[model samples]
Target chain A: MSVLVYAENADGKFKKSVFEAVSYARAIADQNNTTLTAISIGNVAADELSALGQYGAHKILNVSTDKLKNFINQAYASVIAKASEAEQADVVVISNTFSGRGLAPRVAVKLGAGIADGAVSLPDTGNGKFLIKKTAFSGKAFATVELTSANKVIALIPNSYKVIENATGAKPEDFTVETNESDFKALLKEIVKSTDKVSLPDAEIVVSAGRGLKGPENWGMIEELADLLGAATACSKPVSDAGWRPHSEHVGQTGIAVSPNLYIAIGISGAIQHLAGISSSKVIVVINKDPEAPFYKVADYGIVGDAFEIVPKLIEAVKTYKASA
Target chain B: MNILVCISNVPDTTTKVTFNANNTQFNTAGVQFIINPYDEIALARAIELTDGGKGAVTVIHVGEAANEPTIRKALAIGATDAVRVNAPAHDAYFVAVQIAEYVKQHPFDLILTGRESIDYNGSKVAAMLGELLDIPSVSIIKKLDVDGANGTVEREIEGGKEVLTIPLPFVAGTAEGVAEPKIPNMRGIMSARTKPLTVVEPVEVKASSEIISYETPAPRGQVKLIPADDVAKLVDLLHNEAKVI
Candidate 1:
């Protein structure tokens, strides 16, 4: 029995999360005394898939299917399920992404295995049972889960685990799996991508604004700061509801849940619902005019001033710092 | 079009979380439970869809007798009937298995639920149930529109949104943009008293994952005060101490 990792690829290149998932699966395979193999689908190149060896993938299973170029849940699940059976994989790893979120549980059901999504750490094998810790309550707390079944599926939360690069020269082997088109019921007719510069979930640094920004037209300062820092721009739920920003950029319990490395809140009061979404960040900096804003209670750093005046200075400082660095 | 909407009774978002003596279970004392915000969107969407066509909306819950109030709340909102799988929610996997088992007996044209429960925050149930039923599933859906034979759903991706079309009998996890949940009207609230609410014993669920313990997050650090005029000092602190800049 070996560990199989579903390496995610977009437009033929492996995503950054794939390397992290490979690093995680490598550790699990080492503990279990099993080989760690990766499966690549769609238009991915053999050489590119093989290059994942730097992340500890012993071998890559290259399944090149033209129909699998775009994500169709049913087809992808069937392909991964077939690959798992072929490799006799006892443990399967996937990234907790939009695609993974849609496919991981389906694959788990196909394998009749126990699934743990939003996993934050590797499994603890010291005890007789293998237990994985996952973030629950939207990163408010962690829950240690024991996967007692024979087959287990885990979806590692993105950007949570550090990627270990060994630069080991591992080769990719070409493997083919036949998939029937009938299994794919849902069709991805088109993909409409937002023109946002940075993705909130993948952004290491996020600059978020709230109602204090006054109006959507006055968001230029926040955007400038985020642009200079190379960070994603976010808004509070109220801002989104008021049409200051798109609902996709709303960060709160009712909005998009995010856990970036550095989250900078501007003019947000830190309601419990909003805090529940972003409280998992490594460092939190709150900028508000009110000295008694609740966001300061949870912030690692705080600036008690108007966002309009403070944000421009922050932007200039970050620009100077980036230039110097 | 028979729509199935699943609702989970979870602590209100404002509730401060605390653990029991052993930290194996969540402390429910002094905590107010409500219909999950995400599931409320699902319920509203189901009601709207059924109201547009010749269909009925049914709400289902897998919990003990204590959860009946929340079930009644769903019925009071707009659901025509309700089903309570009389069992304590064991875990995400166990609960999914039980829901899938119950769903098999009653086929639904569309299945809707919240993206994740506020308490457990496990977003895997919809996909798991879809897999068990061998149907397509989408999560984090903000917009949903259904025709007689086909349906369209818009799900939020990392940087963008994906608009996909699938046939009927698909699953969708409701997020914010689906629709604002409407408070039950006086007519609906009174009518809910007569709606059918059937509670069935839960089937045997194979539990694979067990919670070991729980711990609260680290306490908030002391807040620092900086004069409004000393913007440079604030920047220095951010650059040097906080290192976020």
Candidate 2:
């Protein structure tokens, strides 16, 4: 049996998260001593489909149909399930992105496979059982889940692993799934792209502020710092709830959960819900006036000071460093 | 319109996560449970959508009798009635199967669930129910509006948002912005006790997965406290020591 992975693409180009998912699947394939096949749905260039080979995919199944031009959860799940069955896949992996989150569970139901979403670690096949570690309780804790079903589905969290290059030079073979009108029940009416400087999920560094910023007008320095570092600007739930920031910019347990390489919190007291969302961040830096702020406990670096005074200086320092380098 | 909102009772967000019984089970001692926050949002939206007797909102939970209080909270918040499938929410598959079975006998025009449970963070129930019932399912919807027999929903993607239209008899996992949660007023709380709270035995279904154990996150190292005045030093440490900048 082979391991199957759904190679998600955006506007015909694969994102870094897709490669990371393929890399994770490759490791699992190696562990199981099986081949890995990646399925690409919608319209993707031949070269783009072949790129999956770089991530250890022995074969790529390209499903470029006009009917499936846009992402319909039901249709995409049907396509992935069909591809998995055709390949005799025992394990199916998908990136835990927004689209993948919607598609994975449906695929699991269609295939009658057990699923573990937000998986942070590869399956531990020790003792003849498959146990996978996943983030639970909104990243506050971890749970090791055992998938007893023979066919299993896993949604790998973004940034959980680095992408590795393994050249397989695999060619893309055309794969097709029969579709009826029912698959298109959910019609995509329109798409609205955010004009933000940097997307939070894909950002390497995130500059987030809480209500401690005092007012929405004081956000100039936070934006300046984010612009200098090419980072996304996020806010805590309170700030968003108060209308200081858009709800999309809110990062916390009840909001968007992000795990960037570096997360810098400015004037944000570490609420447990807010901390739970960013605990997976690689490095955390806290800048607050209160030393008793709980954020410093989990931070890699802490500076007890006012954001108005400290943020400008930090921004200038980053500017100087960039200029000098 | 009859709406079905599925709720999960989870530990309060502030509870410190811990494990017991050789790490095989969550330590429930001295911890408080509440309706999952995301599910609360769904329930709130369902109540708003069915406001003024336009329709009825039904909340269903798959858990033991101990979670009845949580179900009552839904009714207090404005659900027309409640149902509890008498079983533990062992896994996503098992829970979805139980809900689907109950819904098969008692169908609804619309079904809503939280984008993901705060405890397991598994966004599986809505889509699974969609497949089992042969209906379209959308996940993590930020906005939902009903007009006639069709509903419009907006959901965030990686770098953008998408708005879609689906006919009635569909499922959706609600996120923030769907509706602000409503608290239980005294009048509503009093009336909730008289509202129907139906308990039914769970259908025969085998869980496809189980949590083998639970573990807390590794403790972080000591923070390197830097004076606020010396921002340069902190920047240097970030670049050289942490290599993150």
Candidate 3:
């Protein structure tokens, strides 16, 4: 029996989220007394693939499909399923990323394994049962779910598990998996970006604006502050709908949900849907002209003022601090 | 063309979530319900794609009968009709099975749903249903364009967006920006009252997962209210207390 993980790669490097999943699988394998193996797609460098051993993976199964360079959910899921069979994996772990979110459930169906997403913890095997804690109701509450199926899948949310590097020097083994040509139906054709700034989902710090910012033309200060702080720029749903920001940068219950390390909300009233997505953030800071804005209720820090006036000073302060240090 | 949109009835965004003593069930009393915001996006897109007239845009829900009002709201928002699969939403697998079984006979050219339900955040059914139906599935789509049997979809990725060509009879779990969710106007609500609502029994399927219990997260510490003029102190605190920089 083996604990299998799908190590996701981007720009020819394993992402932090991938390492977190491998670290998670490492602990799971140790507890279950099983070897932990990982599968990755495309022509990832052997050294890069082997680097995963630092996270306790015993072997790295490499599927070198050129077309796998793009994020094709179906093809990736198919390869992961085939790799599971090759490794005889009992527990499959993946990070709850964009690709992981689309791919994990398909893998579960293909492997006939019970699956859980947004997992926040390692499985508890005490009492001879497998239970895992996962976010429920969009982070408002938590639920412990029991997977009764012999085989199981867990998709850990990004940043939920801390990565511990243990240099085991795991070697890479080439594996072959055939993906049906028809499985490429929903393939990525092209990638487009509105800004070169750090994307919200991958960002550790996010500086977001809202309708109270007044209009899109006044976003220079917001962008300046985010750039000074090395943070991504985001907006509330209304800001996106009103064309103040691109829809890709919106974070709410309906929009992209984020769990950044530090989320600074400027001029936002903190709608419940908006708060749901960011409730898991490590630390929240709110700046609003209205003292009664709901965002301050959940914020770790609050500043009640006009963002137009306060943001520039904050940016200057950050610049001064950086210059001194 | 028949487009099937899956809608979920969830507690309104403002509702405070709580649980029973054993945490076996959600404490839903006194809470209002609405069509999931993301699902409303899917439903609105389906209506837009169907031109609001010719082809049918049908919304379906797998839930207790009490969710019919939510279905009616979907119809009022411009779905041609709706189907209520009378079953407890036990798990993603069970719900997917019911949808697969229902759609196998009905045969829709397109299936749409929110990326994930607001309550469970499972995000499982679309792909599972796609697998069970032997069709393709896509997620995180921000735009979908359909012409005849061919369709193009744009989805957000980590740092950018990817456009894809998805064929017909495929499942797509939509994100926001697919379309602005439509609220029911007076005429639409009047028309929705007469829209056909089909009821079907769920197929026998066992839940692969079960919820053990629920728990609330620990309360956050009090916020450190900083004066607006104290930019230096705010930065100092961020470096010292929050250490976010």
Candidate 4:
């Protein structure tokens, strides 16, 4: 009868997507005339779970088990299923990140619920039917789906909903659950984390280079601009395939999908695939030598010139503005 | 090791999406179908894992009879056999239920699928299957290595990546950079016909979600042209009109 949200964390800190998921869950709870409760896994402290009260979580369920520190899908799913069963949660909400994408569906199956991923908005429950709108075709279009089942699971698309914060306080109870033996056929042995200073997906501003940067060696300007703006660096798929950038930094349909507030494309022609991954950004700035480049078609702003000469000036301007402000 | 890879038949990435007159269903006329790109990665990883000749790789598809060609393509890609549940590919939960039924009958050491299907972008099937099987699952895995009885997986996070090690019999959704997808060789293609493909009727699980309608994205506006030589003016336009800087 109530909405349950999965609050994700990394290294004991809450991820920004947790707020977004809570926001969506709050709306669902309001519609259902029930309170929203959040569940935290891994090493999240009670204070951290209580902080979610600002996002309209009336109560928080903290499943703080030592074995749940790292994400084991089976273990995490088991805990969530147990919580859902105990709470009798009709609606489940999660962020559409790696963990949620992997865990939400499985949880839905266990609950025998209908699932909607990449949901951009809250469901319409006014007509006695639950209809949710989600982005499909890599964010190209929208699909209105009606969940006919009694239980429903939704994975909210990141950055699509506004995170609502209210002045509220609540003390959450610590709930401990028993995890059974791992049933995964594949066992995880170790974790190797990249030490990059700027991670593209989490960056508010992203400076991306494309083939127009000429080669990998000429990436000084792009890096300089990114450094000046305090932004993460990304590249188009072609640039990644050509070895100009690491495969992890590729931002396109075939690569990582990003929705930063500001996306700056340097020396890149906009292919449809590349556009699909980045079109959801709040603002798009395209820099290409060709005025007729396809990227300009979707760009809110364009700089038609050599990136080598233009990037430096832009960097200088940003520095001057920051210094003055 | 018995690796089970799930493949979905979807419209090619470049296909022009269209809707019916009533906007109730996608226009399927003349649309070419191909193996879901992400699923291809899962299939490739499974084949590579089994290529050492220790275990076998099997591909499964839950779709109509017309999807057999796509299922055979997985065999051609190097799976030992294929299975097709004869049912209209319904919602994500429905499809997951069908696959779970089949998987329960034939247990696997590993299950792999694409992070999400390109067409629906549901991103739910692998997780749903994991829940149904009561197993561990990981999504958007970029790097994976398996040793004797242990597997290490790297998943992409918002700003960084997470590395975890677990035992076998887990589900993983493959994204790019996990492994290069393999093309079917002529020999494999020729031998695919001889491979076993089991067809079974779908279970009585119902779809929880119903598609109300499908619509194409609005056509992109015309391109704005700026003279290439006027870099300064272009910068000003970007700052004032575009407001991106």
Candidate 5:
């Protein structure tokens, strides 16, 4: 059973997270005594395609279709079913990004496969049983799920797996995928970027603030710190609701959940809703005037102080450290 | 403009999660169940789309009798009727098949669901339903407008948002900022009791996946309290010890 990994690309470039998924698929393929194949849609250079070989893909199949460019879910899922058929793949690995969340299940249904989403680690294949660990209860808990289906689809949670980049280069093949006029029916008219700043999903560090910052006007220091640290800026629900930040920046139960390596919470009380989003974060740093803020409870480090004063000092420290380095 | 909103019954966000014997079943002893928060936004949007009694908004839940209260809550919030598929929602594939089968019989011009249930966080059913129904499906949508048979939507993509237009007989998984939830008023709550709550047997579909066990996350370690004024120390720790910077 050959394994297939869907490496996602944006603006004709492969995302770093996609390689992580390919690396994961690589290990699974080797353990099963089978070679893995990587399928990328739209466009990428021949070198970029062969770069996936470092993650141990035996071949790279590029479905260079103009119709497949804008991420129409139905259209994209169709490409996957066709590729899986050609590759004789029994397992499909995908990065659990925004597109993965939209694309994986549809592919599973088309292939009659049992799908697992938000997988935190590689599957355990031993004693004639395959078990996958996935974050359940919104990140509150993890569930060991067993896919009984022969054709299985797994979307690896981003940042959980590290990509390996030392392997033989895979041969790149341009495969033609058939599409009907209806494939382009649901079109993406335009894309409006939220910011040129680091995207939230892939950001290693995130600087987030809440109502404690008072008003939108007070975001100066928060933005300054995020810019200095090269981190994405996020907000609590109330802050976004009040238009102090875009709703896209809201990280909580009702917003975009994040799992960065380092998540710095400034002037935000950690409600359960907010906590659920970042519980997976490797390290949490919280700054709040109220020492009893619930966020401090889950934080690895805490400072009881005003964010306005603290953030500026932190920004200066980060600036100096960067300059010295 | 007939609209169908898919609702999921999940534990409240604040519920302290626990497992039963061998972690096979979720111990639902005292845990309160509410309409999944994301689904609430979709339900609210569905109600507004069918406002002024222009059309009907039907709520569908794929769970056992235990979800009756949550289904009723949807009716109270302003759905015309409710349907309960008699079965446990084992996985997204199972739930989507049941809803797809049910909806094909009682079709609606538009369908809505939360981006994903907060519990499972699968974010699958909507697209599966769209595929099953062969209609356009949009995810993470924050705005939708239906004029005549055409629909316009704005959905969040990776680093940005996109606008798209699709015809009627479509499915959409909504996110927050779509609409404020309608807390059932006294009249609506009273009327919800009289509103129809139909229980239907689930369509037989094999689950592709099964849960072997469940585990809560590891507990947080002791927090290292840094002095309020020690900015350099924190930066030093991040770079040298934590190595995050």
Candidate 6:
């Protein structure tokens, strides 16, 4: 009864979310009274791979191959499944990011394992059933899912768990799996990255706006505030629909759902659909002129005034606090 | 090109969620159902891909007769026909197996589904279909273009995007930027009434997972309202009380 975790990385470096996944996997491993082994698929340096041990990885398997440079969902799933077989792993854990969402189901199918995606809580194993709580209806509700299969796969939602460091002296062992032409059929031809801004999914703090901002021209203050706070920028559906912001920046039921640490809404009336997406945030702050806006109902803090008047003052205050601290 | 769009009938976005049956089932006493929003995007792109009588767009669902109206709405939105597997979508694996069994007898060139259903929020069917059928699958693609026997797609990564190409007879989970959903015109609605609505028995497949219970998020407490003029005080509160920044 051993557990395997996929330590996902980008350009050979691990993200904070990856450490969080490892930490969550470590807790599950502890619960099951099993050792945790982490698998890295890309070409990561040994020193960088060893950082996973700080998050409670007992051992590491490094599978470095030129063929696995870019993420191909099918191939990655196949590799993870093969690793599970090699380790005789009864449980597998992956971060429920964009790539993990694509890889987990296929891996489950390959391993004949039951999966619980978007899992927010650790599995309750005391009742002899591995039941886990996960977000459903796009964060509007929660469902407790029971995995009945002998083998199980869990996709942990990013930022759902804290990254706690535990010391270990684990080393990496080279692991390899056979691949064929079928794995490369869906060819990843190019990658386009937006270099300047923080990605919305990984952002701890998000500054968002809505239709009340009026137009795209008035977005300077929003961007300035986001920049000062090192936060990602997001907008409501109407703002994206009217082409004021990119669709990737839209946070709602139909858009990119975010569960950041701090979500700041300026000039945005929280519609039910919009709230369905962001209701999972840890803290919410609303800035709007309308005191009766639905957003204030869910907000932790609110300032009822013109965003134009409030945001600049907020930015100045943040700047002063940062300098003084 | 023949395209199949898999849709899920879900509770409307504004429905207040509740549970009954010992908190094990969703209470549907007053809930209204609609085509899942992401699936609508998949259907719209299928219709666009097969426009001008180039091919057929068949919409499918795994549910009982209670969901026929929701499936019919897809037909009204430009799907050529519809299919409803006469069984509850027990789970992602069960639903995927049923669809794969039906498609085994009747195959399509391209298959599309939403990134996930709003109800289960399981983005599993597309990948499961790909694995079961031994074909390539891409999830959450923003853009798709088909030319001859090849398809190009742009899929979102964590902080960026990746462009990939796959052959025909592939499965893709469509996302928001794929296409704009089309509203049913009066004529389309009239025609949808006469379109074929086929009901088929589901194949036997064991569910790998079961829902043990349902829970609603805790209601948020009162908001600490700050004076518009007291920006510094708000900052102090954020720094001390909230500790988010």
Number of the top-ranking candidate, with DockQ as the measure: 2
lDDT tens per residue, model 5, B112-183: 999998988889999889878877788788888888988888988778888888888888998977888789
Where model 4 places Cα greater than 4 Å from the true spot, the runs are A183-189, B217-245
Every prediction: chain A TM-score: 0.97, 0.98, 0.96, 0.96, 0.97, 0.99
TM-score of each: 0.96, 0.99, 0.97, 0.92, 0.98, 0.99
Output the lDDT of residue A296, model 4: 87
TM-score of chain B of 3: 0.94
Model 1 Cα displacement at A25 (Å)? 1.2
**Among all windows of ten consecutive residues in candidate 4 chain B, which has the lowest summed lDDT?**
B223-232
* Top candidate when judged by lDDT against the true structure: 2
Docking quality of model 5: it rates as medium
Worst 10 residues of 5 chain A by lDDT: A180-189
The alpha-carbon deviation from the true structure for residue B24 of candidate 6, after best TM-score superposition, in angstroms, is: 2.0
DockQ order, best first, reads 2, 6, 5, 3, 1, 4
What does candidate 2's lDDT look like per residue over A1-325, in tens digits? 9999999888899999999999999999999999999999989999899999999999999999899889998999999998999999999999999999889999999888999899999899999999999999898889999999999999999999889999899999999789868989888999998865788888889999999899999999999999999999999999999999888889988888899999999989999999999999999999999999999999989999998899999999999999987
The regions of model 6 sitting more than 4 angstroms off are: none
- C-alpha lDDT score of every prediction, in listed order: 0.85, 0.92, 0.88, 0.80, 0.88, 0.91
What would the per-residue lDDT of candidate 1 be over residues B1-245, giving only the tens digit for each residue?
Answer: 89999999998888877889788888889999999999999999899988856799999998998988899899999999999988888876667777788889988999998988887776878888888787888877889999878999987776777888989889899888898897998998899889999988888877767778776667767867676666667667767887766
lDDT, residue A181, candidate 3: 89
Error of 2 at B174 (Å): 0.7
TM-score of 5: 0.98
Candidate 6 C-alpha lDDT tens digits along A1-325: 7899998898799988899988988999999889899999988999999998999999899989999987888889999999999988999999989988889999999999999999999899987989999999888889999999999999998888899898688988899799867878898899999655889999999999999888999999999999988899999999999999988888988888788999999999999888988988999999999999999999999999998899999999999999998
**Pairs that clash in candidate 6:** none
RMSD for each of the candidates: 1.8, 1.0, 1.6, 2.6, 1.2, 1.0
